[model samples]
Target: MFKLCRLKYYLRNKERLIILQPLTSSLDEAFQRYSSSAADKDFLHRSILPTDHFQASLPRLPIPELEDTLKKYLECQRQILTDDEYDQTVDIVNKFKVTEGLDLQKRLIAKDKRNKHTSYIAKPWFDMYLKSRLPIVLNNNPFMYFRDDPRPEYQNQLLRSTNMIVSSLKFMKTLRANILEPDIYHLNPAKSDNMRFRKIMRMIPTPFVFYGAYMFKTLPLDMSQHKNMFNSTRIPRPGKDELVVNKEGRHLLVMRNGNFYVFDVLDASGNILEPGVIMASLHQIMQDQSPPNTEPVAVFTAEDRDVWASYREKLISLGNEETLKLIDSSIFALCFEDNKPTDPNAITRMFLHGEAGRIWFDKSLSLIMSAGGNTCVNFEHSWGDGVAVLRYFNEVFEDSTKKSVVHPSTSVQTDAASVQRLEFKLDQEMKENLQQSVKKFNSTIQSLDVHHLEYYKYTKSYVKKSGMSPDSLMQLAIQLAYYRQCKQTVATYESCSTAAFKHGRTETIRSATAETKRACTLFVDNHPAVSVEELKKAMMACSKKHGSLTRNAAMGKGFDRHLFGLKILAEEEDGRLPEMFTDSNYQKINHIILSTSTVSSPAILIGGFAPVTPNGYGVGYSTEDSRIGFNVTSYPPSTNAPNFIECVTKALDDMYEVLEGRHPAKSI
Candidate 1:
């Protein structure tokens, strides 16, 4: 590992040292960092299939130099630590650099060489999720809502659910056929997003496809995660969980009033069944008024992972093994709620972690709808992150809302035999276990608070005209809000996709920068000595710093995941933990007090996740043409979500005023 004395060399030379003799066109520091592009499918193109160029089109996720990562880590440490604490951390990090860390870094690079198909962190990342003992409910699962159906008549709960299922199955079918449009982010749509660009790409050989794409200024995101998007379930196992996927499975699973129903969405010929038949099956479940099952077996999914795993074994031993496989192998789950949500907050809660009795949390994607006629996708996060999920989310919403497969007036036929309600023969022990699961679910969901805001003061146009990245502005406001609330800075995590590379997952954009700290202090203190010019400069500085970090994280050069890989290596080695991992400073930086992500799209209304830490805040926001929206969740008393949102609103308005050079936010 390079010492602090070599920092200048690290900066001057940023080219990655690739381990494999493979694709020559792989990008290095010279390429532009990724800007996440929305999901788009082009049907008119006659050339290559959507994912045909996946292998050739993107580079592997890069590993930053050990020196670069350490420098980045130290820079962030200074933002939240005092001089004394920072000094202590520096000493610890330096010691680790020459000793255990050097060996681990070398081993990590060698392992990356041996595994050319994926990033070094891939297996460890999967193990990180699979080995967690926490329940996947509020702690791991997240929900994203679709905009309401524009044609009010289509908003009937049964009709809407039917269309979503139909659209989703269609998406699955198209995807498996490999004809669906690939997930491509066009940097300049005017140049790369049209029919002409398609023609050029069609003539190019598969080996040169990425070069062709580069000519058009488009980047293809990794489609590796898409394989698990359908016909998959997170199966609970002792000590560790596993993702069980059956691509051959074509049936649909629907949960309603604590009952489970299944029907084949695909026929023996591997074709989507008529939408009328699918809608008729859902209609049967929707019309049923059977009292909820007293045991509510599905709630077991919300129990702690190992506890649920044990119960799962009990289920299999009780002659429900076939039944369990059927549930897991289904394409996905569609849940019909007994009651309509009264408001937006209610909707957020319903989808985030619904009546545990009605949700199969293990399914890769669960389509949930309330009796009031609205829906969202609550997904298991272990198999993938936001890239694959959001793609499916956007495509399905657009297809279902604009080109629905079923309507209220469509033919209705009820066949009890068409849908199978899974029956599990449970013993007394299993039934009692069910009750325990429900109680745990209620306790966890009840302890949380959610506050959503749709601020219409400004949107994309305003941010761009002001010459700032919209996401950066949003991050700045969050830091100020936290400072305004607690009067100090803490570790902030904003997720940036590393999907631009092969088998890429996610990287962290540590949003709490020194500039943000200074800006937050200035805004909150409102000291007369701090001129408006100084405050404006600080805000601008924060925006610039945030943008740079975002780009670096997207390019797979962030410090968090690199440090994570090293820490995991240290744990696997036969020795005491490295001091770098043991340092109190390392613990503080990894706490992730403000876990935030942006879920912005025209088709999506909002998305949210529970705080990763009990006392932290889970912030989900979206920036639209008309407004910028936020949905904040926290465990109350430890953190008041409502008060934080109030502070967030003030911070946004204050920043906007500063940008406009208008009535100085309170102190002018």
Candidate 2:
């Protein structure tokens, strides 16, 4: 026993030392092995390492020295050859070169190529650097870093800054490995062209992250500026304090996808026209400059609706040049019933109008003051996501209220690009063959009874017999559907279910910051995908494999591996090999099929909410041509829970009958 212990100790120590030695290597040796190889060196010298190569790249430290220092620091920390350190060093070096370095170069040229390629490395270092550096730069050099002088317009400045930030974030995320956050920020410039400073600021990080309370003092459109505050656009060296403050109300609409829609009431143009002046000016422009006899007619009351209708009817009747031109370039009226103002000082009336096409309406509290009723208006602007609609509304409202006549910074007109059209010609023979196949399938489908609901029910009951929860049962149903349709098996599948525990049902993790309360706990289960009979035999096996850890284990495994395993299992014969099953691979799949009961409630709610009453809800399934694809969402009424089993069974029968070239009715 003493001899054995000594031998074990010697082996363990030798393994430890071997791991430690490579991490303590010299910076010069590490760089030589990891950096440019002879082939890469030639490419670098010829076209990549020139001084002008990185003119547009972010300001990075000088190359060889920066690379050398990073390598030494990583070595001192005993993290040499680590993916994170190596990537950071690579990024610094690559930025100095014109062309990005090749991935295989790092593998073939590095001394510890195996370690470098073994794992993801760049994220951690980049995350740390961004968090540390961004705040400092913003605080110290906000003007120089963000400002654009040649483009005196704030909108131009905003556009330039957004592009810069996006480019920087993309580089950081790609070159680093340990990063999680994927968001960036942008500033919104106000509409006023003459106003020296744009009032509103905007920030967007993700496709869904929208937060606006982080920047600025007053709301964007504060229309209260002093005359002398406007500055020349040509000033090369404007002081940070020299920035103008336009008091006209400003509004900023921030979208999830880092775009800003800003509207300010200040006049950037020399002539600042207030609301009344702007309206009169537009009317004049319409009459004097607009095409002949295309004046807008007001439709203020129900009485006027008849007159407007008659005018339209007359235009159609005339069919002459003048009437045709008028019809072609018509301006419809936007009228409202006169009412007492909610607030005397309110400049913009908030209205909600449901236009035939898309349009904008501002719903700011200020609008409530001007219009006594809820501000609703109909205008022509296409409705999009909530973020986009909000942005458009704010822009239109601010533009209408602006005291200046400024030309739009960006052109609203879109340019059409060349389109390539492809056409394929098939002979009469091919057409006849396709038509025959379709006719045969149609006849087969018309015949099959194909009601597979009873089978589906039997499967569900069989799954329940194994003692799974309702959620787990739903997950199993989805898995079965996939298996039936795709004939594929997966090693393990995990479903994340939210479970609300009653007292004594389950233990809870305590919160360090707040008093612990009953909360939804995440449950994950990974069960082997086997036949109904096999599952029954493994009943006791379920208990050992089931628990909270299953959730973490599945997440750690990742989506790609889970999909890959499914692909592999689908290729297996009968998808069952007894010895091949392992506890680790026995995961419940990340899929769910809404049972009939589950669909009924939501379907009822949706039906109730519809403007027009719905006739009924029907559930059905359709298979895809792909080897792995999900069935359609099933509903109720025509094919609700009670009849879902019947519907799916029928669909499957129809599918098989058609595939096998038999009459579906005969199969039934």
lDDT of 2 by residue, 160-234 (tens): 222222222222222122121111112343432211111111111111111121122111211111111111011
The reply for model 1, stretches above 4 Å from the true place, is 1-47, 415-417, 665-668
Off by over 4 Å in 2: 1-466, 490-549, 554-668
Task: Report per-prediction Cα RMSD to one decimal.
Answer: 7.7, 27.3
lDDT of 1 at 493: 96
lDDT of each: 0.82, 0.23
Q: Candidate 1's residue-wise lDDT over 1-668, tens digit each?
A: 12322433432343521222122223211111221121122121112345555456467788888888999999999999999999999898888888888888899898888988888777889899899999888889999888888899998887888788877876776677675678888999987786556544554556556655655668878888888989999999998999989987879899987899899988887777777788888888777778888878999888889898888888998899999999999999988888888777888999998776889999999988888778889999889999898888888888888777777778776652288889889998888788888888888899999998889888988998887789988998899889888988999999999988878889999999888988887888756666767877887798899889989999999999999998888788746678788888899999989999987787888999999998899999999999999999999889999899999999888878877786455632
TM-score for candidate 2, please give it. 0.19
